[model samples]
Target: MTCLFRRIRFVLPTCLAGVLLAGCAPNPEIATVTVPRAAQHVSPAARALLPDPNPPYTPASYQSRSLAAYYGHMQDKLLASGKLRQDTGQGVAITADQLTKDFIDIAMKDEYMRGGSGTMHRSMDSVLRRWEKPIRVFTVFGATVPPTERERANALVASYVNRLARVTGHDIQMTTRENANYYVMFMGEDDRMPFGETLKAAIPEIDPATMNVFKHTPRNQLCVALTFREQNGSPVMGKALAMIRSEHPQILRLSCLHEEMAQALGLPNDSPTARPSIFNDDEEFALLTTHDELLLRILYDRRLKPGMTQEQALPIVRQIAGELVGR
Candidate 1:
């Protein structure tokens, strides 16, 4: 089974244009906390490139520290068991046929479906989704995240943005919140509830069930991404939000970043057969592998337009996969 926390919702709310609204009411407690300038580690060059710095962060609560320790221990155990492999080339060999099948499974399916009651249910069905517009990512740090960690997260996200753009040959860049349609938020335990309110304000169409998941994400689930399409049932995505827990250790945090951001790009489901790939739930790869990059290339290829059903895109996918693998 896939990781329960790796959520992807393709929503088509009535208010599409207001999906990324401005002027969210700030939480008083969160607004009062501030980070000291000396605590920040962002270099001058990176500072100029990144979004405006977050307000001074509050110290982590005892519960938050305990949770971090638990996650850190879990990561160490996984690494010791050789499960979370960072080496992309270490996995099983791949072929054109396998790539084609994996693409259909990962790119053309939904992991979670929203019912009429707004509750998310686990269901699988073929659906082609991809962004037609330029992807502008904005990062938001929680009040409990220290400045040094925020700097590291910002740099990691910025680097990954460039990497994805190169892999897909698409226009993807990091931007300020004002211009960004994709929001990548790093929320600590203390920030989750308050941030949910902010999200509701920014996205008024956000349903109660979705807010419940965000505010009370299970501990086993580390991160999630939700993408929104136009109201007319268009497959082209216009907005996306990815939330990464601040309690994760460096490696796990980076892993969440890799999978969630890439999933938001369109490959929203996991397949057990996907080897050397982060899209699988086996935790075999902690980073985006060579095979995963090929998947992204295929997804964004000009020949395969967004919204093409699996039956319609399979032949083209097979041909493209063959060319990619030199079959």
Candidate 2:
């Protein structure tokens, strides 16, 4: 009976191993083209990106403090150049699908010092692709500010940084391009990779010598626009929403959520504070939008588009330009 029991135990162990091996075979091939990440999912352009995963699970925030440090270094460069003038805000529209797990891995390994941990907001392994629309912010300086008043100029620069932080809920350090004077700060939504990465790749090489076109456009072209006064309530957002719906019906709404300046602008990559801000403890803002803002230049085309002649176009262009000048 002891001999029989030993034989049965050995056979049972061998059978279990065989069963496990049989279950390890590769899955059958399915013909499918890998999805390509196109534009910011938070924009109307978002629909052009890819679909969200079913039974959706919130991804861990992959905000990188290390990258924000690089932003600080870049801001120092712009500030020292004496080119940056007024405090400015800018945002990039990036397709999260463009970000690959491999790219995140490589960046963290090389550029950033994050180890193989969830702390950096990267996925553990390959999975279905998703989309995000993160907005980056920075300060812009005025060209006529005169280079001689360095002290006042720096103070102005700091104020601009504060205003930008207040507007987008990002506490970003400003940076400048090689030839420019102002530092371009960047901030994006939580764990949204391509959005932040896209701006980081662009600002360092921006030619301040060329022109400040961003000065003439909306703060974040990536997001639908909403104008708020110093003391207005969410009802103001309702007006913007009505405009979006009446003027542009085809666009899809992403996040009209208002984010708090005090909370969102503090520490870098703080996921808890990065969510949409509410007036009286709501989950999101009363703000509204359509996905097609990138192509939805309703205001631009209707009021700002230049005509065939330069003279014909200057009025509209200048009017919009003046608004951006913060007058």
Residue-by-residue lDDT tens digits, candidate 1, 248-273: 99888898889888877888777888
Off by over 4 Å in 1: 1-53, 90-92, 111-124
TM-score of 1: 0.82
Locate the minimum summed-lDDT window of 10 residues in model 1.
28-37
Models 1 onward score TM values of: 0.82, 0.18
Looking at model 1, residue 238 earns an lDDT score of: 71
Kindly state the number of residue pairs that clash in model 2. Answer: 27
- Say which candidate scores most in lDDT: 1
* Runs in model 2 lying further than 4 Å from the true structure: 1-63, 87-307, 311-327
Residue lDDT tens for model 2, 15-94: 00001012232211101111111111133343224222111233223333333343344334333443122211123222
Collision pairs in model 1: 34-56, 35-56
Cα distance off (Å), candidate 2, residue 144: 38
